[model samples]
Target: MKKILLLFILISSVSFGQKKLDKLLNKFNKNNVPYISVDSLASTKAILLDAREEKEFKVSHLEDAILVGFDHFEIAQTIAKLPTDKNAKIVVYCSLGIRSEIVADKLIKEGYTNVFNLYGGIFEWKNKDHQVIDTLGSNTEKVHTFNKDWSKWLKKGKKIY
Candidate 1:
């Protein structure tokens, strides 16, 4: 119960923007890497990496999330763009977390000591009521689903295919 209360406080403190996050975390935290809950990550300081394609990122992405294109993902090339310290906190996410998991694994293999994969990716980020922005760098509800089949997971906002 103590853990629950502490979580509540953290949630309240980072309650920035319109993220709903009402969906049980258990439902979406089903990932390979030790998952980072959206609320938990939101309240912490870390490098948020977007592991989607360039086109997908243009649709919308988490505030301050650095784009690292997945389809053409290259780990060595990404290193230069990464924080100079390999031990720095890093959280990666893709449209649905699959790609991010791969990216996170690569980061770990490349000597990164603290790498975490965002639980559900941009879909969850938008669904939870967190904010995202467009290619123009303007705040928008639009999110790219990668396809019609994937769009179903997005429970909120304008779905940009």
Candidate 2:
């Protein structure tokens, strides 16, 4: 009986762990990320972070978003550069929302008061017909298409570039 209960708990935890992110995402404004929209993001003074690789980031990214590239070194530098306000609002996103989710958890653990993970990352934003500005070598907003066939679930509506 104890073994059965343990197994059930394990299964429940595994099944529901991701849902925590859903709630976290909803705690902020909406439209772009799950919890926060682009307009809301613009108005709420949240810091935007793009966790993609440097090469991919060079292709395109959200306007005014800081690039951290999901590496330990990059994350450290990014954190160091952040303002001293522990309660500042932060929005982190990566391709398909995986890395951003992980980063959000890390931020929370590190004493950040308000953190949000963009639910679908830039992929969903473009699909929703939202604009994405790029800030890198060239300052041009490009359509952030998920360049893979399996990404169909991410693209729901119009495309942007």
Candidate 3:
């Protein structure tokens, strides 16, 4: 959709001279789906799922979000944490958004309706001044960049190595 792509461009374009995020625009999803925005997410009643690795997750994540992880993701594990109502609204996200799309796709196939991928993941979320919490559930400016290259996309957070 134009709105999603435009928002993606607006968000990804924020980092000066950072094309690293732009290069991954179409890398993740083989099948495109509707994306959830940070503003909308702030007011929504959906369950949030973090699709990053455990280490990445520990650095920071959306408050109350459950980590389903990307590399070691187990559908069984996700099922265990999911609400009993299969129709519950769910949003999946990762560092950039690609990996989360993968997770969201799987959720759709599993027949858990009303699933969406967060447009730009935690990077955009924090950029928009949204709060992310650490393991202790404390508010943190620290965010796990995943690596040196990916760290450039984050502007407002204290980048964690």
Index of the highest-TM-score prediction = 3
Each prediction's whole-model lDDT (CA): 0.82, 0.64, 0.85
Q: Candidate 2 regions off by >4 Å?
A: 1-34, 37-39, 71-74, 135-150, 154-161
- Cα distance off (Å), candidate 3, residue 121: 0.3
lDDT of 3 at 77: 88
User: Which candidate would rank higher by TM-score, 1 or 3?
Assistant: 3
Q: Return the top candidate by lDDT.
A: 3
Residue 157 of candidate 1: its Cα lDDT?
Answer: 86
**In model 3, where do residues sit more than 4 Å from their true spots?**
1-23
Worst 10 residues of 1 by lDDT: 16-25
| lDDT accuracy of residue 37 in candidate 2 | 51
lDDT of 2 by residue, 1-161 (tens): 99999999988964574465455445532433235554466556778888777765766677778888776535567788677897888998776576676777777778887888776577656555566655444544454444554244344433332
Error of 1 at 6 (Å): 26
Model 2 TM = 0.64
Candidate ranking under lDDT, highest first, comes to: 3, 1, 2
lDDT of 1 by residue, 1-161 (tens): 99999999878854632243324334444444667878888799999889999888988998888888888898878888888899999999997677788888889989998899887788887888988998777999899999998787788989988
